[model samples]
Target: MKIHIIGGGNLGSAIAVGLAKNAKGNNITVTRRNIGFIQHLTEYGIVVSQSNTEGISEADLIILAVKPHQVDAVMAEILPHITNKIIASVLSGITLEYLNKKVDGTNTVLRLMPNIAAQFGASATCISARTADLPKANVVTELFNKIGTAVIIDEKLMDAGTVLGACGTAFALRYIRASMQAGIEIGFDAKTALAIAAQTALGATEMLLNQQVHPEQLIDKVTTPQGCTIAGLNEMEHQGFSSSLIKGIKVSLQNIKSE
Candidate 1:
């Protein structure tokens, strides 16, 4: 597949690198516009840092990674050039309707919510199609699966996916910090604390998935009756861990419909 990616920022760069490293038989072409725009990529083979780049046209897939405010300008510049290709975007807050309106084509446009973990092929991705038939969606889904886990969800649920999976990375990091702090209190080194916290989080997620058990059930299994672990867990619950997490998700969801 001939792929062209626009924009070269953090999320974009990560995805680009992820693709670059895995593009065994795939054609990957990234546009950087001009020398002043992405010179860094010149040294790194179409790197996303600042330099001139080829225009859009040779792509079976067009991935847009521009900022929300700048999406219109980019789309307008490339809209007329689009054909029956797939337009995959990671730009937040912009609806699929707005994108299709700006970039006219019989092409299938998809909105994806992916975390930075895409760089490591572990992202929890959510995709929503605009005018794509199952064949195209499946093809696109398979392509992304090379870099992460992909799920085709309802458009209405995409925002919640963004909240819990996309923006939720920051919240997960915060939880890791809290875990590390508690580890420090128990006399562990900072490095060891972080590693243990990270591993524990991974294990917890795996258990939830493999065991197919509710979170409360898992929690009950972990906390023995009248034990120290139970005491600590109870105190944390009393201080509002679950409530706070729910509130954070609600706030993140509100950000989606915000102007």
Candidate 2:
């Protein structure tokens, strides 16, 4: 695959680096006006450029990772070269309908939400395309799977997926930070506390993924009648831990929809 990624911002650069690590033998180019920020991508044999049209002309897949407001200008510059290419957008709230209308419905358009974890080959990318475009979308799904897991979803649920899959990374990190703080208070130094908290969270996630069990089932395994685990869990519940996280997710979705 000849992939051209525009914008070269955090998300774009992450995707480029991730693909470079996992999708060997595929030519990838990432463009940013200020090329210094992404110059390091060359270390992985990725061609870094400051020209969108140059990249788009040579790519089989063109990923638009620019800010939502920049789409019009970008389309004006590269639309002519994009015919029949797979056009994937990582811009939040930019729907396939908008993209289709922009490209005059000639290209295979896909909307994808992938977080920064893509740089580490662990992002959970959610993709959506029109029913007729599913076959092409699957090609994109397979491409992204090289960096992380990718799932096809209904366009209507894209906002919800953004909240849960993209913003959710921060929410999970916040939980880890809080856990680390608590660990510190319980006597471990800051560095040791963070390592333990982060590893514990990773282990718990691995268990859920590996066992394919409900989270409550694992909770049951950890909590005895009056164990410290249960005591802490109950205290957190009493203080609205789960409810707050749910509310935060809901608010994030609401914000995305409002935009």
The candidate that wins on TM-score is 2
CA lDDT for candidate 2: 0.92
Residue 199's lDDT within candidate 1 is: 97
Q: Which portions of model 2 show Cα errors greater than 4 Å?
A: none
RMSD vs true structure, all candidates: 2.8, 1.1
Which residue pairs come into collision in candidate 2?
A: none
Q: What stretches of model 1 exceed 4 Å from their correct place? A: 33-55
Q: Which 10-residue window in model 1 sums to the lowest lDDT? A: 44-53
Q: Whose lDDT is greatest here?
A: 2
Give one digit per residue, the lDDT tens place, for model 2 in 1-259. 9999999999999999999998788999999899988889999999999989986766899999999999999988998876889889999988888988998867788999999999988899999999999999999999889888899999999999999999999999999999999999999999999999999999999999899999999999999998999999999999999999999999998898888
Q: Cα miss at 41, model 1 (Å)?
A: 6.9
RMSD of 1: 2.8
Residue by residue across 147-227, what tens digits does model 1's lDDT show? 877888887898898998888889999999999998999999999999999999989988997898898899888888899
